[model samples]
Target chain A: MHKKLFIPGPVDVKEDVLQKMATAMIGHRTKDASKLQRDISEKMMKLFYTENQVLLSTSSGSGLMEAAVRSCTNKRAAVFAVGAFGKRWYDMAIANNVPADLFEVEWGTPTLPEQVEEVLKTGKYDVVTVTHNETSTGIMNPVGEIGEVVKKYPEVIFCVDTVSSAAGAKIEVDKWGIDVCITSTQKALALPPGLAICTISQKAYEAAKKVENRGYYLDLVKLYDYIQKKDHQYPSTPSLSHMFALDYQLDKILAEGLDNRFKRHEEMANYVREWANKHFEVLPEEKYASNTLTNIKNTKDISVKELNERLAMRGYTISNGYGKLKDKTFRIAHMGETTLPEIKELLSNIEDILGL
Target chain B: MHKKLFIPGPVDVKEDVLQKMATAMIGHRTKDASKLQRDISEKMMKLFYTENQVLLSTSSGSGLMEAAVRSCTNKRAAVFAVGAFGKRWYDMAIANNVPADLFEVEWGTPTLPEQVEEVLKTGKYDVVTVTHNETSTGIMNPVGEIGEVVKKYPEVIFCVDTVSSAAGAKIEVDKWGIDVCITSTQKALALPPGLAICTISQKAYEAAKKVENRGYYLDLVKLYDYIQKKDHQYPSTPSLSHMFALDYQLDKILAEGLDNRFKRHEEMANYVREWANKHFEVLPEEKYASNTLTNIKNTKDISVKELNERLAMRGYTISNGYGKLKDKTFRIAHMGETTLPEIKELLSNIEDILGL
Candidate 1:
């Protein structure tokens, strides 16, 4: 089926991005390969709103998220969970055997500054994790406010999962004092899956050095060391194809203007939220709603499976509520290269199918 | 500035392979993504000489090797090291906190069947790892003979790293009792770096079930379970761009014929070895020399780095010996999609530069 993805991630990719991926291979150790990586990192630094170095990995964003927690959390980690992705941080911590404490909020609720402040007051952790746009609940956490709370505890490494929020929303890594800010290509970046990019502060690097057994491949210190030594290249072989596509896509993103791109996402989210408010309920509070995607409460007692079936027949597909919220809500992602017209079209089709 | 790599890995990639990587991006969750992955895996099965399931990971071969060891080693791992990469298996195990023992052989020496038998006879391990081709020393282990030794312990999972030898060497995965055969693109496969492929048996999957804390991203059991559920797709977003190139490149490889490719590699290795022996000395014994690359002894007391610098001036790059052998020896990688004509030209250039 030639269905367009309206899901939270692995969203519809542009043909140009795909074409960039198919570019001929090059020697990874060659100047051409370094040029490709260097270009991607420089552009990625701009996208992440950081002047710090950008590191690329071939794994999904979660890998780096895991790397961040494992690498930087020498004492303990205070992981705040607003939704599924936040929970994933705790899971990643436990799986890597990193000592961490989980702070869970209700599914549709966002992580608040006060909650983070309360946790930071404890001073028991050297690292903290926050998920910036939780795809499962469509809650965009108040990371900017939380950043204020975290900055007071400079010893604590602030790691943000900007996987779904980065390109759709603003995340000024340096400005917000986030030590490690991670994002993946498959999300709002609108590139293919499999590659992740992050910016690590000097503080994060220091914290990583203290941690032991931070396994190879995802070893943050080793990666940072290699980049410093090799002039922006990764220690291991990188996904050159993805780097090519990313370099091209960043130009498109920047040409659209970063603020303009953020606004487009907001515009799409607003359109979907308004439409859902009239027909059903928006899952997250209007004050905490995500700019990248909207979660619609199934107030009309509608079957999402049936709605999706109808949507699929029309050559479009959105996602159901994730994990515990599967039937109670559904999600519509408006991130990445998706345009205003595409969003309107998907909404109209959903409305027609739902008879709203 | 137009330097060609002959460094065992990150080999000189063909223009077509690079071109394929420039393919347009597609949604990873879409049918297109599934098709690409399925196609790559099916083609990879042919490359590994197995009907077993092929899993694609957006990591270097080391990542998958770590995954295999971490996931499959429930009791203990008996890692046999012929060179650096073989020692890497033990490193991964120790780093992951997995119980493992190393059976070391001298550098540039092939792992013997008797050494494997001695270790397995202890019955202290449920997993064993061996590197088919050790890039650091140019030793190709006797995997077939070692396979017979491992077969005695049916409960023990056999993992092989063919990072530098996969496509250039014939590895009958099932026939050789290899529960996990790991390989990456950039080497014998002659694609760009970034992606690694592995063939996994049911036993390996079952073994991973008992091992806790396999870690996210490289969790082999999770990967296997997710693929079974998602039509060969990964739990994490994969590197679709690499797959696009890999699919196209695999077709080219198959078109050239696997046996013919192996023969070409052997001929190149023999040619390089003979030339190096006549000029200086062959590092490994004739019986143990790699079919993928040749390590040359620095009998002339020549500076390997200086020789490489001289070669670089002529637009070619060969590797100096790694680790302790850094200045004592040098290496010429004959693997990847390198043709005999290209190898002959590279050798002739070396001769011209060295005036030997």
Candidate 2:
């Protein structure tokens, strides 16, 4: 039906981005391929607002998040959770047998600075992971404030998952002392899935060297060294098609201006939030609501599945509440290449479906 | 110019295969996505000639190779190397801090069955890795003989990398007693870069249970467990576009018949070898020559770079020898969807350009 996607990720990719993926295959070790990879890495660093080395992976954003925690947590890790995604970091830690503890907030609440300070002062952890944006609850953590507290723990590596927020929000990665900032292509980058990119600091690299059993594939130190030696080519082959599309999309983002892109996301987010508040309660606190997506409490108790079914019939689709919030709250993603006009049309379709 | 790719990997992708990657994105957790993933896995098992579980990764074949070594090597590993890719397995072990030792044969020599017997007699290693085809040396090891020897040592986990030969040659993975068989899309699978598929056996899963620090993402144990739990969906997000293309291509391969595909590859290999032997020395022993590619030693000591340049002008591209062998030999790949007619054309072009 050619439905427009307004989900948290794997959003509706632009035609230009799609075309870029159809680019002819090129030798991975060729100078041309090296140039393309190097260019993308530099552009990604700019997007991350950091001078740290940028590393690319072919797996989802969670892949790099796991890599950061597994590689950089030489001693122990403190994982702070606001929602399902945050808790996943701890799960990753336990499953990989990495020593870690979790400080979890309620689903709708953000990870506060005070909480981070309490953990950091204990001197129990060599690394800490926090999600900048939680799509499950439409909550964005107070990373700037948390960053200040994290800075006091100089020996600890600060890893941030900006999977759903990076391009849509103002995240000063360097200022935040974020040793590893992870993101994927499917979210605010406005591209198809399958590629994860990160900026790795020297702190993270050094920490990785101390960690034994840092498995291959996502071995941060090995990847860093091979990339430097091989002119930006990975030890493992990467998704070249995704790189082609990402290079093109990043240029588009730059053309639109980073601040302008963030502002567009904010404008669309504000519109959606105001609309949701007029009809129902916002799921997250006003100050902590995510700029990329908004969760609306089903105060009126409408069937979100039914609403989305109707929206899909009209060639548009939105996401229902995730995990525990299903049916009790619904979400509308406003990030990526999605603009205010598109958000307005989506809301208008919902209004018509509900006869509001 | 649209040049024909005759390299070991990043092989020529068909236009329809490239188009499949342009398909619309879908939510990874949705029913439709699950169906796509499940269908691809089922088809992959057929291609691998195994009834075992097939796991897919967004990264290249190297990712799964690393996963196998990391997950299955709980005690110690004996890595057999004939060339670059085989040495890579040992490198992965060292990077992951796996207790392992490498058994290296000369670059063009195959790892023999007697060697496997000697290694297994020690009872010192619980896992072994053998590259079925060494693309760098144009040698295909006698894995079936090694498999028989490995079967005698029931406790040892056998991992085989068929990255360049799986679909193009006959590999009865289940009958061969291979615990983990890995291959990527770019080689004989006749697709674009990205996407690695592997089959894991029950024995390997048991071995994985005892292995710790099997980091996330490529953790074969976690992937196997999660896919079983989630009905074939990966624990992390995957490349849906690659899945689409692979699913479609697998159908094409089946329609062509596996025996016929292997025969065609053999015929192409023979034709190339005959041509290379007529004009130059064959790099590998004839008994161990790869069925997918042929390495021609530069007996004339001509400029391989200049030869490739002239060939490029004629709309074709082949690879020079890798690492230490560069300029001493050249490679021509004839696997994947590359047909005998195309092979004839490429060989003719080289003959004309080099004035053979």
**Whose DockQ is greatest here?**
2
What's the TM for chain B in candidate 1?
0.98
On residues B35-61, what C-alpha lDDT tens digit does candidate 1 reach at each position?
888898889989888877888888888
Q: Model 1 misses residue B258 by how many Å?
A: 2.6
DockQ of each: 0.53, 0.67
lDDT per residue as tens, model 2, A1-356: 67788889878888878888878888887787889888998888888889999899888998888888888987899999988899999988986788999999888999999998998888889998999999999999889889999898889899999999988998888998999999999999988889998999998898889898777788788889978898888876789999999999999998899999989999998999999999888888899999999999999989999998888899987888989999989999998989899899999889899988
**Backbone N/Cα/C clashes per model:** 24, 0
List where candidate 2 sits over 4 angstroms from the true fold.
Answer: none
Docking class of 2: medium
Interface RMSD, per-candidate values to 1 decimal: 2.7, 1.5
| Model 2: per-residue Cα lDDT over B31-96, one tens digit each | 788899889888888888899988888888988888899889878999999999999999889987
Report lDDT (Cα) of residue A321, candidate 1. 84
Error of 1 at A277 (Å): 2.4
Cα distance off (Å), candidate 1, residue A186: 1.9
